[model samples]
Target: MFRNGYKMKPIIATLAGLMLIVALACAGESATPTSKPTNTPAPVATATSAPAATVPAGATATEVPVPAEGPELTSMETYMQSSGYMPEWGEPKTGGIFKWRVSRNNSNFSPNMSGTTHGLFNMPRYGSLIRFDPWVGFTSIIPDLAKSWAWNDDMTTLTFQLYEGVKFQNIPEVPESYNGGKVRGDEFTCEDVGPSAERHVRPPKWETTLKKGQRSLWHLTGVTCPDGPLGYTAEVHFEVPLGKTMSALAQGLMVMLDKDWLEWYNTEHPAGMTKGTNEAYHLGMGTGPYIPGEFKSDIVGEHRRNPDYHRDGLPLADGIDVVILKDFTTAFTALATGQIHVMGRGSWSMTPAQVAQAQRDFPDRITVHPNAHLFGYGVGFNVGRAPYDNPKVRQAVQLAMDRDEWLLLRDAGELPGGMKMLALVSGTPWSYSVEELEQMRGIRDKLTPGGQEDVAEANALLDEVFGEGNRELEISCMAAGVEYVEDCLLFADMMKKNLGIKVVMESVEPAVGTDRSKTGAYEMNSGAVAASTDFGDPDDYLLPKISTRYNANSSAVLRNLEALKVNEPELMLWLEDTIDKQSRELDFVKRHAMVRELENKIYYDLALYIPFGQRMAFPGTGPAVKGYRLFDLSLYSNWSIWERVWLDE
Candidate 1:
């Protein structure tokens, strides 16, 4: 699970010195007014204590006790009992019904959607204000539905508190969906946590989830709570300093909705709600532990549990269906004929040689569960087109192919000459060592085709960047899987047998390769599985693919920094002042030596993307499932953990 040694627990090694409390630097902007209101406590929901208190005037807070039926253990069952993945097949048994599939078809159940296939249909119907310690990494952050929080001092202001019996999710076909007809199961207040964290920083449904230069809630400005319903308390306010306000509220679309059923569905669907065409916001209504039932879209969805599931005894299944196959060899042949008990090894799963031939065709009724794949696999380059913006044609396509033949076409020939990755930190915490990524450079060594699969230095740099045989290009396997058609037919047969080039191939459809890699249409694609910005830091894995505010370089991996802000405006202002000073460095050995000095100048002096291979996550399960355990953290690693699973019989 943690792939060999890499330790750090104490719930995320105490959040890098407990989030360096705050040193302040406008991490990409929005919290203006530096100081005016020193203290304004007039909005109470039950404040008047002192087992240690202090607020907005030098922060303290602390109260927390309430353990009547919750917390006997949970911070994901104490990170599965300190990562030994819990008392194996014991405890956690309530009911069963946990089938699974989903390799596509989820455009709603909005926590402001942004794929993980819409977090397996809205993380079993929403609930957040922190989560992910599901087996530590993603720098931990627990406390969902905020039962305790406080920061102030220099952390702009944080606050939280609420958990007083968290409710919401009664839905009877939206019985006049709140604010008026009120049938969305109330009482989850502090006014629904400051408009659900200001709906991920406002604007007509946040321009459908912050795409244009995504700053993810550009430093959230306001959100104070307290007014009637007697104090659940929220507070919030940020201007971006505490490590980009704790990795922008530890994102998974930063959930927590139901503010009167989202202001009565944005006032009766006023030209909003698109994904899954608003079946009452895709059967949404959270306070999670499951609720939405029988939805359709890519066909078949359901969920039930939540008999007021504010943790007590818990959701040990009794509902969680999901179907939507869309091929991965027909969802690994419906999770190998047991008709699905769990499949999600996401990025549309399967292919570790179909999870090692479904663990040898279900020996002891399967149960793979390998994690460490937020995402990675690369080779992109459309770099403002034409001979891939020539750097000896991206160093003769990384010395004419050979990431161990893309790990033997992703493990089909089974561990063909053992895997090897060039970068995209294997299983992060800045993974290195395969003898330190085979002595770096363009990984496993190669600079301008210096040699690492040299193919005569890649056909003398494709015959001095296209002269003799006019080395062709185009390689767009964007969708359809089987490891993107065996890495586009073995990277077009190793560029026509080591750089006589002429390779073509095109497959399209992951929404047309995310809009033909953002309009610089294809010249070479099949990159970006680079997932994991769900907070774990290495600037959440290299600042959103080399940030320039996420233009993400017109797509097939890294290029446009506004065309180097106009041909090297001092290297685009020192790559935007050192990725905004290493994303506001909250000192983890100085942000790991400023992210290994900007990942060795973006993987060996701006070679601009080519890593290839690493993103595994198996998660199989079926020996009467039991309290299934595989939450290698990012967005609690899929299949919405069927509310802590069940069925030991």
Candidate 2:
């Protein structure tokens, strides 16, 4: 999100001649800081005295009541009437450079090695097997790379036919022995995909593992490349039924790489060679709208439009220039000054005052897009640790603070109702139950009953768990120096006020906080895990929070893991099965019930980490910009689509 602040100042002119010169200099150009007053007008009220003696002179005159005028129509209605869906149209005039400010600089360009943060930019530049069409609510696997595919009834065996006309970006400057010269597009076949999958699945080379002992894992059993009726096809067989397998394949996996390029680079650099890093970072290629042009650590990474891209009409921008500014203030300043066009990755965090100023100043010049992310922000306790190790103590902590109070204090006014607790948002299925949520109120009542912190109840619970007069039980909280930290502090203060248990707050750098959480260094952490968008399976939430094997990085409860494993196979297989709607829904509800039942055992944190409100914002642009929809996913990738954008005269 974009935000700016305005300082209130009184204007006084010392010299009229100098002021006049300043005014003339500013004319016909963008407003400068000293040009105009930023404050708005206040309301004024007028008083009227009643006529006394005048009535005597006009005794026969009668008073008439004037009819009230109805409220005027808003400007939005006027615009809608003036223009249909083709608002101010001709065709969408396209062609201009759209600049964006990214919060971090990414060094990893290799799609195979790029993690989620880097992948956001790379995905659009590099095509995927399947694509998400939000409007259609389904997945599309374009035959640009994969010609076609066949799936078995059991969904265990899947075959993909490869397209002939495809080639990686070619660098003519490089020697022929380097295999940097262009290869015929038709030479690309099914043989390429199998090896890529094999490479991904292979041992210590890549971190992703497919093991048999794990029933719920995303384990691929076999992958084969064979000649087929359509030329050649790659067959992939999974150990278990995965309904999201196709979606995953379309989303991330199956990005085809030139086998020759990979082989040559590997041979030239060998393993662990420093020169290999340069080849991987700079010369690596893909068949996307954009190609990696240059990368410098902690500085800048540039992506240039691909001239040989296979797509019919694509890659709107000439190039994308991404600069990493770890300092948010600098990034925000750059955005306000129009130095950058976009904010890459993560939601924008802004003060309420800054948000108000941006709305007032930019108005139509900026756009704000609010997305529902999967992660939650709340207090998570280590169930194995002291105090929280006891279920009653956990319940007491849940009851101590009203979530509404915390929302008001931390979010300024935003509520958590809009936030998604489980994988799905509030309106969707698998969200929290109304009755169960109301139970929280009852829990609060049990603590204080008077809408205040109940010190007696907290102390009693703590004393019962750790014996009376033992206020020395240590509970460590991990917090960042943000609103989230304030929320944690609020909770901590309430715990002390109501329960007599002293809680310590440990504020750390965001990166350090993440590392600590991953290493299980804190007794309680304030954050959440993000689930996949457009996918609403309960397993996404349940497994990650409770599965010991899957969430080995977390210090989740062991009993929760054991209980989850009881119906693990049933839930896993049922999730992917192509069954009737009724049957599918029933299984989903059953799985949810099992997880909810285990949740009562104090398996996870009492307060499910939910967002108070969306923190990210996109500012609007001027009339010169067109064909851009705020809050909508770019037809291609977030970073790549900027090229297609063009400026209007």
Candidate 3:
């Protein structure tokens, strides 16, 4: 049986130099070993000795295998032991300006915004009540603004005790800049925390726009502020029972802002303060470790370490400079040439050739870390449309394309089994069983022979749905100008060759894909869905993609929306009962069966979005860079302990 309780250990070794392979491999499955030399010379480093740590008996100590025998092999553990860079039981070195090349500038910085741009910036600089430590690989709730929290009997209401020393960076009346200025005020109190929570629950202007021109908080239900020592104890009530609410709140939602600064920023920059405007550039008042210093729209954003940062001793870096390189090629070049120390979100841009070249050229300078969560990129067919409205047509399309072939064509390396349908959730707690997957394959086999190059089968299904005519099907997809547009064209070409179905490609803005998919405007929208870090439940996989509430806007594409809406209550109840009664292993099996039923109904036919075989890449310096870990890919990744990292140089 696969152990669900497996936790990752902190990477403790520092290689003088290391070669990292950053291929776009298939999701969920381990990569096939390539014929590469393992005993390459280590990069020269200032520190040459490693630390010693005992490996517990019976604990797994699997060494990464070297492919070809060339030079004597030195284990990464032994390398760290020989080098004095191993992490000791104390805070890491913390002072240096680390420059990172980012692909895009943030559109908004508010934690409440649902976009990826906002989500990325909000998590690192801002302090969460609880945070994930990638080094130790555990979730820890820290005493930042909130000192302590307790749960109710039903796990519904969570009351938090606020810390007194916490203070927002720039309140107008106090006039203390983030640099060396001093603010004449008591440490942040319940007055700040209470109102902030209350506002999220019931904003004064429910539909009002923010200073950044973004939408207001209208989705929240209620927030009750604290009264006494207890002044910090605020009660939050939910509309429905949510198990991950605390985690979500701790992740970023509960980030506190100073009331004075909020009011001043709004007054000083009335027009700029709206949700979509670039007003956040002028306003930086969070109690985070870093204070926003400079902002160049779509070019760069600089943040200086906060001198008054509430964390006892954190944010080891002197400053963080984020340079936005919208082009992947430019970012990759920067990483290869040592123009930047780190690169964020470079996975989608790396090709097979680039991965090989990086390993060859800058073998010792870079380290690549794969994120554990599912990041799916697939095609979504609008089921409300005519041709796809037919279940047989959808099934025929699934049968026509070989997932393995598509992976090879796409240059994606390896993927977990059953990844063709559910690209991201292939091997986790939510992965489907092999038996159930085989049953799905049987359904596909009945429609096509060998499930590859079945032109007649595809044509037969297309003709059955649209009738025997020269009338072509219009499958609207994003233009090739977008990143994954080629994948859409690949799907189109396969369908035309095998099924004799001529699909007219419609290209539009990337946002149009999201709009069309949500509104069911297009017959099919080839897009991708990235899983949030806190996601563990299968509902996280299914709800936004297919739930009635989420799909209401795209109701046009859902032929059976009305029927599904009626059955939603029962489905939700079934999901809850399944969760309560079975173990996680059985729960995944049951969930897989349930989602398979939905897939059969053809609400949306799954297409290869992630293009299995592509591996995500996170490039960073070796262990000499303090606070650096292989898993520091995102906010949820190991970089959360920024204060713990220090420069050895």
Using Cα atoms with residue i matched to residue i, what is each candidate's TM-score against the true structure? Answer: 0.34, 0.67, 0.68
Q: Residues 406-501, candidate 1, lDDT per residue (tens digit)?
A: 655554212221235544454444445466666554455333344444667657767776666676555544443334655666777767776656
**Alpha-carbon shift of residue 354 in model 1 (angstroms):** 11
TM-score, structure 3 vs. true? 0.68
Ranking by TM-score: 3, 2, 1
lDDT of each candidate versus the true structure: 0.55, 0.43, 0.44
Model 2 CA lDDT for position 24: 32
lDDT value for model 1: 0.55
Return the lDDT, model 2, position 312: 35
